[model samples]
Target: MASNRPAPEAPFIPAQRETETFGYGDHRTDEGPWEEWNPTEDSVRPVRGRHRVAKQRGGLARSSTVLGVGVIAAVGAGGMASAHTGKPPVSLSMPDLPSVGSLFDDSSASDAARATTPTLSKVGVTSADSDRSGNAGEALRNRIMAQAEQQQSKADSKATAAALADAEKQSAAAAAKAQKEAAAKAAAAKEKAEAAAKKKAEEERLAALAKEYKLPVVSYTITGTFGQPGSMWSSGYHTGLDFAAPTGTLIKAIHSGTITQAGWAGAYGYRTVLTLDDGTELWFCHQSSIGVSVGQKVSTGDVIGRVGATGNVTGPHLHLEVHPNGQATGIDPAPWLRDKGLNP
Candidate 1:
């Protein structure tokens, strides 16, 4: 709190002031007449209210005066040094004064106040500035971590997609390969089935032919077939089928035909020429004996002659030849017999 009381007057008079006589007992000197003075509350004008200073005891008055003088001198020196060096002046904050009770009582309150006061260490930095810098660094670190995680996620996704695509391609290729294999197997199966069906049809045709015609010689071994290459035959190759059997094996007519010629024919001894109604001729050569005359009508399976080795032959066998349409040349009699449903 503030006080309205005036400051106390100085006890000593100023040298510049003119000498004056006081009502107390006076003494005269060359300079002036002075009176012995003692200050009391009435003369000093005591301070009023909360702003009043307590009376100093012991050596406290001298100590307080010295401390105040030292503080003022230090502050003035620091300000002058800053000005001379062309540097900014540092701000000094004074600690709050102790309460009146502390000054009047013990020094414990003053010591406590000094301990709690804040002290500045750096010129321009404060606790709040440091806190802001720490916050910024933490934010930057967090952002870097987040970016790393995001990049890793993207890489993982790409890898997964690539793997999936590769798997799909492999699956597609496998399916295509299977399909191709299946088609090849189907084609092979179809070809096999067609071949089997054709063979069966040929067998059925031969069976039907067997019912209509008979073989020329029964219980006989086919010693020679037509078109066999051998020097023993008169032509370059054999021209007829030879059925070997014992001499006098009954020779029968192969089909219903007329005996066009029945006589010995030179090289084809004791031959008989049977002419079919369609002019196809069958020659039965190397006969032991002829049973039919020329111009005779013979039915199928009739006795025609006997087996012989009368001609140019190595054994007893019947040699049969066929000529289509009375041509001089002959065809393979095996095929002709097959045409008449015989397997000779």
Candidate 2:
């Protein structure tokens, strides 16, 4: 290392006197006026103000002190350079005596040489600072990338969750729809089964009634149904079921009944009324002749009268009417006969 302390000044030495004169011999005249003398600071004449030594150029005066300091700095810097560069330090030596002109030369040459030299410590500091800067930049980039990835992951998770929710909703709706359709089908099937059961029960009842009743006339064609509308009838509608047959078709009792009346009616000629055990009156009109008398009890299938086309009639047919409980107003006889197992 170089010290910052100032360099020591060089010692002053007086110029040496010539021992012998140039043209004179070694011996001197004893009687001459010359004397033996030595030069001293006070004895020499001083230069005047304008005659003083001029100041040197290029930063500092040319002197042994400045030269010494520059040499010390150069040696220290060279040694450090050698250590860092893996090279051997160059040896530097000083001469025992040097020329005065060499020591007093311009200092500009030395400054230019020092300025061009490179220092190991300065380069090392710069390299270390650059490494630190690069590392900091890399760290910042990594943090930014991590944040971006986190955000993307969150977005993907949200999208997936939304899709799953939608799918669940659709699935639930489909399940509900299927359940409703199945329930509807079950109800319709139940209704159809109930209707079939009702029809079966009705057929069974009719079958049982068929064994207890008989039709009034055999081999007869139904010509007019009850409630047939026409101008020919006085009531504006036919009041009885008309059975067309030959003039002498035999009429039989529909059920076990008593003959209540056997006489001629105005519009229904030769009408015969048979009263059942329940007071239901059955009238057999347009009869050619009455076979059973009033107040006579007859069983089913017993002969009652003969079918004929009588009063207010255009053909040979038997008109049958029914009155519940002997009411004067008659009801349609077709359904009444069906109740007794007869499809008239």
Considering every candidate listed, which one attains the maximal TM-score?
2
> Ten-residue segment with the worst summed lDDT in candidate 1?
27-36
Model 2: per-residue lDDT, tens digit, 116-168? 54432332233444575588679889999999999999999999999999999
RMSD of each: 18.5, 17.3
lDDT of model number 2: 0.73
Question: Where is model 2 more than 4 Å wrong at Cα?
Answer: 1-133, 229-232, 255-261, 275-280, 291-303, 324-331, 335-341
Regions of candidate 1 where Cα sits further than 4 Å from its true position: 1-132, 226-232, 247-264, 270-282, 288-306, 322-344
Deviation in Å, model 1, residue 341 alpha carbon: 6.9
Please give the range of 10 consecutive residues that has the lowest summed lDDT in model 2: 27-36
In angstroms, give how far residue 85 of model 1 lies from its true place. Answer: 34
Which residue pairs in candidate 2 have backbone atoms (N, alpha carbon, C) closer than 3 angstroms, thus clashing?
Answer: none
The TM-score between candidate 1 and the true structure equals 0.50
Give the CA lDDT, 0 to 100, for residue 142 in model 1: 96
lDDT of 2 at 122: 38
